[model samples]
Target: MTDGGAMLPWLVIRQDDNGNRYRVGSYATQDEAQRIADSLGGRGPERLYWVERMGQAAPS
Candidate 1:
């Protein structure tokens, strides 16, 4: 469970040719995660996603 003041964890994910999503790294902010994901240009398809904390609703 996360308190109102807590910052959620963000993950930088990349998809392999087999379409399996793998975590590149965890970050404290979405911007940080995005920067890392963007830095992997031409490496593969990637995106930033929020890691759902306990008691938090999943993103629709």
Candidate 2:
């Protein structure tokens, strides 16, 4: 987690070959997660949020 809520953990949502959500992933850095989320590039139209992993350890 980051102070001032500037940068925090995040889950990079992705789908499997069959088009199903896979396991929820947590990242130490938000930048890394953002990259994964960016790869998704929005499917047609969907709501998304860039959030931190609750009760998860912050970047060391």
Highest-lDDT candidate? 1
Which runs of model 1 end up more than 4 angstroms from their true locations? 1-8, 44-60
Per residue, candidate 1 scores C-alpha lDDT tens digits across 1-60 of 123666547666565656565666666776776777677746634543344322445444
Q: Candidate 2: where is the Cα deviation over 4 Å?
A: 1-9, 13-23, 44-49, 55-60
**Cα miss at 49, model 1 (Å)?**
9.8
lDDT of 2 at 20: 56
> Whole-model Cα lDDT per candidate?
0.56, 0.55
Lowest summed-lDDT stretch of 10 residues in model 2? 51-60
Q: List the residue pairs that clash in candidate 2.
A: 1-58, 9-52
* lDDT, candidate 2, 1-60, per-residue tens: 454666545666544445555434666677887776676556544434343465544332
Model 2 earns a TM-score of: 0.38
* Model 1, global lDDT: 0.56
What is the C-alpha local distance difference test score of candidate 2? Answer: 0.55
Error of 1 at 45 (Å): 8.6
Superposed Cα RMSD, model 1: 6.0
